[model samples]
Target: MPTPSAPSAPVADGGLFCELYWGTSLAEAWSYGPELGQVHAAPDETAPLPLYGFTLPEEPFLLAERTPRGWRIHVPPSARVEKSLKGDAFHPVGPEELTGAPGRAAVELREGMTLRLVEGELRLLVQPSVVKERAGRFRVRDVAWLITVAILFLSAPVAFLTMGPDPARLAANNARALQVAHDKEEARRKAMGLDQPLKPLTEAERATQKQDGGARVNVPASFGVR
Candidate 1:
């Protein structure tokens, strides 16, 4: 039998930079673990403020372990940092309660990249992807979702006022009501020019709606019936 693999070292132990807030955390606060390259939550090693909620600042730095004691972070001393890293940690190690896994596709996001998380990592193929460009003619899908959600939220009062006596009746009518809402939403989407695929207008479709005659349109009611 293979010499019993020396009990595998814990993924993180005494010291090393570790993210406390995980990804909810901004990229600016990852701190150095005094020893194991884990995040230092202790003051003597981490030194500063915020007894809890402390994390290593995310930036290039030299992380070294202190013997007998725990980890110590060498942060470029600053007034703001002095303010934040100025407290003591109750637990010698950083908070153990947090074993947070990454969100959606746990992929690390470089600054400004709007990442779509896939199976427990940042969706690959776009690692060093470009930051999102500003709004242009078309609203992106996320923007559309936000707009739809707002509309639904504003409509909540209407929903509450219209709820009937029976919960079952409410449930029974919900699908039809939702279907009607869907249809109305579709119509609104079309009016905003969002329902159609985006492409240059076809020459045939752009052909004169007037026969080059007067300001009046030459469109037959039958022409647009479909």
Candidate 2:
């Protein structure tokens, strides 16, 4: 007869190594890595295993608590953080989005470690990084939009020059101006009673109303009407 054995614990390979610092002095240093089948923290390797918390990497991808200094995780500049649960997709994790909590805020490191901030004592589990694709500066849609805007900006002056001013509109404006001038002149003539055709002066009328050729005026006529 064969004897059944107990299930063996799961193995943990890597986790975030957090070192809390105050000013230039190191306050605390802990490594959150997998030990056996559960997540645990160690001051070193021989330290006692304390069960802290659990994280569902399949779900929201994060399990964290608030700290006094807020959620401040230092990421290496050379490494980029990406996230994908189903393993086929991944996107670059932005700095703002990395401040995650109440949701998945865990980031995958390039060196095969998963990093997350936690409150209280440190506890960690191993989750491998999965990012097969990388993004560049400009996408196809972005480049197309930029090109369209540039074309519009550059062609504005050329379009304006080519179109010029409307000839029909200018002619209509000139005609309206001429009509306005004619109407003004006609109104003035009507007001002065000179709008009608003039009649030629008769000889008697002209003789009676004729002015002297010299500068001298008739004294009686100049002084009083007669």
Candidate 3:
């Protein structure tokens, strides 16, 4: 078994690989091809597996090799395999239980199938790189959303200018508002007795009031005199 080391970059050959999921969350992923031959988990102090949280066996217990037909995983006594055929429910089985071989305990992994290791504390989702690559490519819906965003961005200024109030009308509105405010202030001053308006008497009323020989002869009707 090969000692666990830092995972290398993915190859462009679009080969099948296993995705390592720690419970419900994906932890790490490893790719395998004919060039690398096989992959395994063996303890190495210099460069340990990048996985965190859980510890793997100090010795090589889990091994995956590229077979002629597909990738085959060998299950040791310390670990048990749980295979999911429909991706929703899983069925637990011994390594030899699937192969029906008493001595050898190995099974080939298929695409879209999930495998769970009881002792390993992780699940493996089998898929090909081509599928992942295709999924990463932009779809029609993504392009349409981008177009909609661009249209909104480019049309923002136009919409604001079109829907905005006219400058001439705004100025007229401001003038009217100032006039109304002045009228209100004047009314408020009068209500508070801070401002008073003088009333001029008519000529006849002013003529009615006179003084004779230092005594008043007639008074204006406004003075409450008959």
Candidate 4:
């Protein structure tokens, strides 16, 4: 089982780094970003190594650093480097190969190039950073929707101001409504015969009428004789 470690640090401005894949498994890898500074490959007894069962030497076998062009791998004399996967043999390097003095030899790794180290136990791949543009130019269709919404918002007040009737027209409508109500009332009175002129009561009929507005009562002459 191969274990992958989280990025040691946040990706910074340089946006360049080297990815070390454990053996042939592409899924198990570690990213050495520029913010990580320098990375040393050495065995630690206290911490469990997640290098897919491969052990590094007691001394630093390899050192990885970020360079102006790309990532540079420093290889000790004891270690050998397989520069390419396309039939290139593992070659021994010395300090003289890079800086022309006595130190660990350095090799610049470009994008898509794989480097094999520690007798082909570890593999490193160089990957470039990808940036996406967040700000985009507005299209005509995008602006058209905004314009339509603004027009709808502005048209509400204009429609409310223009659609209402003027004061004179409102008064005329009220007068027409009152005339209709009066005409309906007159029609109802005529239907019930209440609209006809009343006939005057004679003197005998007036004598029988009640003074308290109650209905007139009539009594027979022999009602209490028995």
Candidate 2: 10-residue stretch with minimal lDDT? 62-71
- List RMSD in Å for every model shown: 31.9, 18.0, 12.7, 14.5
In TM-score terms, candidate 3 sits at: 0.43
Candidate 2 has an lDDT of 0.46
Clashes (backbone N, CA, C under 3 Å), per candidate, total 37, 1, 0, 0
Stretches of model 2 off by over 4 angstroms after superposition = 1-135, 209-226
What is candidate 2's CA lDDT for residue 66?
Answer: 23
User: Which candidate comes out best when scored by TM-score?
Assistant: 3
> Against the true structure, whose lDDT is highest?
3
- Model 2 TM-score is 0.32
What is the C-alpha local distance difference test score of each model?
0.37, 0.46, 0.61, 0.56
lDDT of 2 at 123: 26
lDDT of 3 by residue, 65-126 (tens): 66665566665545567888645788885435466344346776665555665555666555
Worst 10 residues of 1 by lDDT: 77-86
lDDT of 1 by residue, 20-50 (tens): 2324433223333323322222324354322
TM per prediction = 0.17, 0.32, 0.43, 0.34
Error at 90, model 3, angstroms:
5.0
Query: Per-residue lDDT for 62 in model 4?
Result: 46
Off by over 4 Å in 3: 1-70, 87-105, 110-113, 120-133, 136-148, 158-163, 177-226
lDDT of 1: 0.37
